[model samples]
Target: MKWESDPEDFSPSATIVPFDPPLPLLRAPMKAGLGDRPSAGSFVLAFKDAASWRSAFRATESKILEQCELAELAGFSLARQ
Candidate 1:
């Protein structure tokens, strides 16, 4: 975790609540309370262009678990928003 959102924690939540970064370059993370962290629906890492997304995914393709979309969606769903 030493992400910008939580430099202090190892597995820190990246973004703060309310102000979602714009799409394209960035995608929305799911959110909880107006003051809470991002929720599941916005769990995905969105990109401005498809190519960059594909490239990034390909780079880490081997590490990915859960082969099906359903499973993936469910995983994200259970996660905090």
Candidate 2:
């Protein structure tokens, strides 16, 4: 997938509710091994504590639903490790 450098493209549409220990958004650099498709890329969100982790997870879940409703996404499934 193409990654946009424009901050506006990644901005959340809804106002994020403030939570304790405020979850800071982390964007990891994308990398690939030999033979990997150039279009394949991924980013990770790292949390410093459980509170931040849970807060981000819930926000992500809610965002996915909102995107689907807006036709920006077809569907999504959660896979917890």
Candidate 3:
């Protein structure tokens, strides 16, 4: 699994949502290790807090899983609000 755990090293895939927008976004990265076919990638989701994070996860859970073309959900994580 290619885990990009370091936020600093993830700048290329990083983006921020300004607080002026009211609900700023947080970053959640997911790795999909697709078998041994060299089909792996990262998914970046932004939210303001854990609640929003979970909401986003739920929103994408079925849609992402149904596709199942990007390997697997692998896992997801977040920083503090």
**Candidate number with greatest lDDT:** 2
Candidate 1 Cα misplacement greater than 4 A, ranges: 1-45, 63-81
Which segments of model 3 are wrong by more than 4 Å?
A: 1-46, 69-81
* Per-prediction TM-score to the true structure, in the order listed: 0.23, 0.33, 0.26
Model 1, 15-72: lDDT tens digits are 4456668645434343344454455443454465787778768856745654566677
Ranking by TM-score: 2, 3, 1
- Residue-pair clashes, model 3: 1
Candidate 1 positional error at 67, Å: 16
Q: Please write out the lDDT profile of model 3 over residues 27-71, one tens digit for every residue.
A: 655443454234334543345478887987887997887777444
lDDT, candidates in the order shown: 0.58, 0.61, 0.57
lDDT of 2 by residue, 1-81 (tens): 468566676667544556689544544344555566656654333455788668778989999988778663333322321
Model 1: what TM-score?
0.23
Candidate 2: C-alpha lDDT: 0.61
Better of 2 and 3 by TM-score: 2
Best-fitting candidate, scored by TM-score: 2
